[model samples]
Target: MFELTKLVRPNILSLEPYRCARDDFKVGILLDANENTHGPALSELSETEKILELNRYPDPHQHELKQQIINFRNSKPNKYTETNLEIDNLCLGVGSDESIDMLLRCCCTPGKDKLLVCPPTYGMYGICATINDIEIVKVSLTIPNFQIDIDAILQKVTEDSNIKLLYLTSPGNPTGKLINVDSIVELLKQSYSKWNGLIVIDEAYIDFTAPNGSYSQSMSTLVNQYPNLVVLQTLSKSFGLAGIRLGITYSNKKLSKLLNSMKYPYNISSLTSNVALKATAKEGLAMMQNYVDKIVEQRSIVLKKILDLKYVGKNLGGEDANFILVEILDKNGNPSNEIASKLYNTLAVDNSVVVRFRGNELNCTGGLRISIGTEIENKEMLYKFEKVLNELNA
Candidate 1:
């Protein structure tokens, strides 16, 4: 019999995780785990505060929240009618961060296995690999367009069997481009079968690709067909529920169960589940769509206004995501990391306007990542940006 225990490190195999109080029983006094018996210290309980069962342990499975997510995904319109998913195919995490970490823990043996990632993408993928002591193989994305260097990725994975996971961010961070679905499909068909490794598509900004109830641009529907594929989504971006810290993973039933088994019990708190439930409902979905529409509209306005600035150069990405990555040019019309860093610091420290500086990232030599904000906020950001540029140039 091939046992999974052999894959786990000997130290982890011998270890016993701390058992929380709620692990024993959910009802009848719940004295097993050491919790505040007298209730949390609060002079007055609000409506939501009164409703939450802080005394009891949260549902380890989060069945109700999972159902809401399943329904929400199915509610979206895709080209194929068979895009429906069930609870078996879904799992919740503290955030996509947890899922990413757990996936490495479950599959990659520390110091023995490795993962592949395209550079100038999400930073967490590499950070998590480093934390786990897993080797990371970097294949930089093609410059200018910020698309995957498919040939290089295929070559690396084929040559190295230790590579167990591949992380790709659609609507990539810093670049703000959507990796084309065809390019991904080609990689899956041509390369994934050869290595038998998992491909994780991080769609944190997927909702910005289209309007609500529409997922034509998302690759989530392909999960059902591709056993090796895993799609990660979050309520943080378009849903506007970052505080609740809810992230979702869609994968094959077997892999989903394995991830669940390895994850800590009660990872999702009851308070978070309650808030997410309301947000996934019909009324909440409509409200989220309205906000997305306005953001998209403002994004166009911001893009145009930034391009008109004398110091701003070409926008680096496809502009599919909610943010814009614009190059900062020097007086000589060349990309200037020094000027970009200066402007980023000036805006954040003095003007109270915050944006990311990606001047050091690959292919983004002099880039500033500005997220789409409200109309007034966008105007203010541009004003501060121009002011800082003029001062520096003067």
Candidate 2:
């Protein structure tokens, strides 16, 4: 065991994780997991027939799913090619969240080593780091707009800091602002030369930016050029497979091999693999493309409306992703929390609709992090928002 393992709480390191049937998904009597041998719910019978695969273990290597992803990327005219990197350079995980934990487990020494994060970003990064017993070094993103101050990040990384990882979320969660591609490439180049830390870019929202075609060129080319860079993408967002929980990480072969070796076997369920495999099918891909187009269009309208709103005014930033993050404040300079609470309460009265809130911790407090909903939902939101603003003004 590594030195870090010993430092982790005895309950944590040696603690036998809940051995749900889902946890130990390998060869077994199947009885241990207590899955209903009788079969799935009646409504899901059609899907059960489509998969036709329950008797045997899923492909431990996930060969079909890997090929489909490679094909999907290859079909893109803008994708990068690796002269030496093979499909072996990639590995599938339950979600990017799993890989996040796996990377910390493989690299950071618990209690002694640390990872760097720019917050008001993804909460998952912090959660995974804590569970692994890795100390978090939080360098808050520059205020107003949550763009990273690369200078501050670089300055903080020192010989004594034991910094092994740096996390950047593109079109960052809650903030919905993308860091410039040139800026990110520059950071990767400098960090690798000066420090031994890994630069991980979480591009979960990439598909949302496809129609705009901003980073499409620069991002793909730069990632392969930097050996220390690791890029994570997911099927959950644009692919509309959130329940399936498929995430892809693009990295150099050496790191890929290590991640593959450490991940628990069958971490992805056979059902998930099948759903993901089907998603890359002709009809499924078309559906995803259509959804992305609609989202991009709807996101634009929402941003404009938010900017036009009497209370929010011009403080809202131009969104480059499916969700828009705008600053909402009353004339009193109160944060958006009160207004968002009112909106949430109003929408949820029927118990059929709901809106999400990202508090002040993200620098967008008075702002609501509204996701682009269906056409009806968007219109309803506009009506509700207009009513709320009128009432507040009254």
lDDT of 2 by residue, 160-274 (tens): 4487788888868877777766677778767766777777888888777644332152243334467777778888888988888988777766566667766666677778888
Candidate 1 structure quality by residue, lDDT tens digits, 1-394: 1123443345555555555665567778667767776775788877887778576667788788888878877777445436578898888998899989987887788888998999788889989999999999999989878888888998898898788789999989988898887788778777645766888899999878854244566667667767777889999999999999988988878677777766788889889998898898888888988998898889889999999999999998767788999999998899999999999999999999999999899989899999999999999999989989978877
Those runs of model 2 whose alpha carbons end farther than 4 Å from true positions after fitting are: 1-51, 77-85, 143-145, 159-161, 210-224, 315-318, 331-336, 350-352
Model 2 clashing-pair count: 2
Q: What is candidate 2's CA lDDT for residue 32?
A: 59
Could you estimate the TM-score for every candidate?
0.91, 0.82
lDDT of each: 0.83, 0.70
RMSD of each: 3.2, 5.6
Model 2 clash pairs are: 335-366, 336-366
